[model samples]
Target: MWWKTARTRLDLGQRGMIMGILNTTPDSFSDGGSHAGVEAAVAHARQMIADGAAIIDIGGESTRPGAGEVAVAEEIARTAPVIAALRAEWAGAISIDTMKASVAAAALEAGADIVNDVSGLTADPDMERVCVESGCGVAVMHMQGDPRTMQVAPDYEDVVAEVRRFFEERLLSLVAAGIDAEAICFDPGIGFGKTVEHNLALLRALANLNVGGRPLLLGVSRKSFIGRVLGSTDLADRSWPTVAITAWAREAGAMIHRVHEVRPNTQALRMTEAILQGGNSAFSG
Candidate 1:
């Protein structure tokens, strides 16, 4: 798959990019309200960049299961300032994590490079138009349903196949709407409205998703699935599992990783890439 460059084309071969999550909500499932304020969020973004994050994903609303929706004005208020501050402070890519077109457009204007829409640009009717007009990178993700009721009892005939189909259809829609294919990326939406088995299946079959040759993003950082597998509900105790998932994703050809813990994930991906390139495979093993 190929990604667009400002002046040239870029290849994602065996390279893995890290996208640091900056939740600006006061009630996110994990680490909410910690970075809700603009100063705290900017500081965290700077730290993530220092720890080797290729992109900073700033989310205004909490999408955790059963979470309430934030007003559009409030969402804009929560995310725009952080995006603007990070754009001035950090040199790496900044992504606005919202499904609202107005919020995305405002963020791009405030200096965001990408739109990380968790709803796959289907939540808001004008999302596609905003993305197309801004010419920014777009990460289209697959979610079975809205966050409020998604995890109640999510089911799929075939998890991987359904995700692949979702990506294809979303890509086609975006392309038809005048967005360049290179500006697109596919995300499987790891914990959003999915069971542990479904999440595992999607991760195992991640490379099968063909979104018109766009990059693939995998986000499974300290999620509930790790807790479910390890028999722990504590988010803080899932760090090791998060690192393991990062390594697994690296070996599976994931172009980008959305992670909570940036440094460890970065180190794991770097070492995994070295091993895959035929360098010190024994040590990695």
Candidate 2:
């Protein structure tokens, strides 16, 4: 099914769309404090929209491994203002990158368009209810544990099968709770609970996750797996690698890419789509 956001209609079987990342936290793994303030975050969100971002994902708290949790009040404080400002200023969709149902509901009330729950709606019982009540879009991602220790010797005997099963169960739960399947998207939670090898395997086998026609949202921007492959620890220096992974995800049937760099990856997806669709002349130009 195709999910309609404010600016993009994601055809589940077609080429991928771009969801630009805008973190309001002070310690996001990448590009964190750079946009911590409301003004800075708003400015960056505008720039991303101008750069061809279809969706701007705004996160208040850092979900980096080993990062401490933020209070619900603080998370709401950090994200609502930016979400409000962006909704007023930007014409595209706004995805609240949060797990807390209170924060998600507040952001939605403040004009955000989607809820990107990294815990796959398992973190908070009220999460599904918020989505159902708001009728907003949701990206339910699979993370084995909390950010504090998700990477501590994470194990999966059959990663792809396990992830697919998890998505199936969660999708069933959401549907049973009255959430429309068309309003849902899924992310495999790259780097959230997987080792480098596990991450690679998931990426390679991403096409196997065609969950009854729901759109797939693949977010592998500047992840540690890229560092492991390229022998680089600096996240800022991994733009090219991120672009490569975005293209790979597109080829693997991902319907959206949550990314840090919008322009280059946008260009890459356009080219990749053109080529994949038999050199369609409209996209070629």
Candidate 3:
């Protein structure tokens, strides 16, 4: 499983890939304003790269549930400069986490390699054209509703099956719009519009998604669903659960993990990889 852009290539399934989340917003549920400025966001990207991140997912808008949308011009202003700086100095994959077409286009021009659209390419009709023209890697995620109202009533009958159907439909749409199938990845959109049970079921049934061998990306890092499960509303308390999920999901066939704290998640994935590769005991060798 190789994810390729004109400027980047990722060998998926060789090991779990960590996508460090850098939110340049004041309202993301976790670590929002910490890197809202160009300088700060660039510094954080450098740190994530040094910390073993294979990809940096930069978002200018907060997609956290009930979060208001940022204007396209504002979104571009927030992310493009950071992306440009990172591209000038860094040589790793950079993903523009936005649903708007203009923001994605600007980021690509400024040196982003992937379009991680939380809207699953359904937000702006022009999104498909921008991605097709740029030939960047695209991550189409399933959100049950818009950010503001998604959490208010995330209802589903057999959530896993429904999400798989969503992927099936979207994959066709994206391919028809001229995206190479090899450059496409699927994210079940955990916590996007899911209740706790919905999120867990999707994680459990990942192998069952019939996406024709595309990589499955999971981004449950410090999400509210984790808090709900752990009975802790605090964002900081979700790290352990986040790392635990990374290990568990990797074993369950998750090829990529989008996380905020990269080092711990990287360690967890490494340990899981070692164990899976038969490095279970000190004396085994």
Candidate 4:
């Protein structure tokens, strides 16, 4: 499958491509303030790219549960410069993670290729127009509610079905609004509003999502749900678990993985790809 972005098309079949997450925010739940400046952010992006990430996803605002929103101008200030610097040296895909149209527009102007709207473009009415005008790839995600209250007693009759319905609606609406169907990818929003069970249910049902051939993007990197499931609070301990999930997701037919530590996850996906592609040639050696 191909994901068409603002400047180019990406081959999704290339070994479960990793979209490295570069959070340029001081309040993100994980890795906050680590790459808050342009230089630091650029350095990290370079490291991730060299580590085998096919795409770099930069986000300015903290979207952690109960996280407050950042202003459009402030968000752009945090992300646009970093995006510009990366674009200068990198020709690979760059994703701007923001919910506001103004922030997305500025990042696209500064050379971002995809808009990773955590709100799924439902928070900002102008977002649809901006995406249509820019022709950038979009990672439309599912969330039960806004970030501030998403996790407050989050409920789903059937988390997998509800998410699939959300994707179905978004695919039709976005295509009807002029986005090329190939330019859209569906993210189940793993930790957005899910309990441990809900998250697990979606992961197990990855191949069952009925999105009409669109790519499925999974971002479980360093998320709190992993900690909750593994009974570990240290963010450092979640790497292997995240990597394990990466391999599992890939085998389950996910095409894109959004991750914080790109190297290990990259290795996991690459190895998983190799094993899964083994033909029916019986082992003779």
Deviation (Å) of 269 in candidate 1: 0.4
Q: Identify the candidate with maximal lDDT.
A: 4
Ranking by TM-score: 4, 3, 2, 1
Candidate 2 wrongly placed segments (more than 4 Å): 5-13, 280-285
Question: Which candidate, 3 or 4, would have the higher lDDT against the true structure?
Answer: 4
Total residue pair clashes for candidate 2: 0
Residue pairs with colliding backbones in model 3 are 66-147
- Backbone collision count in every prediction? 0, 0, 1, 0
Q: What TM-score, to 2 decimals, does candidate 3 have?
A: 0.96
lDDT of 2 at 262: 92
Q: How does model 1 score by TM-score?
A: 0.94
Q: How many backbone overlaps does candidate 3 show?
A: 1
Candidate 4 Cα misplacement greater than 4 A, ranges: 279-285
| Models, CA RMSD each | 2.7, 2.0, 2.7, 3.2
lDDT per residue (tens digit) for residues 37-113 in model 2: 78999999888877878888999889889999999999999999999988887667889999999999999899988
Q: Model 2 misses residue 85 by how many Å? A: 1.1
Instruction: Note the Cα lDDT for every prediction shown.
Output: 0.85, 0.86, 0.89, 0.90
TM-score of every prediction relative to native: 0.94, 0.95, 0.96, 0.96
Worst 10 residues of 2 by lDDT: 276-285
> Which regions in candidate 3 have their CA more than 4 angstroms from the true location?
279-285
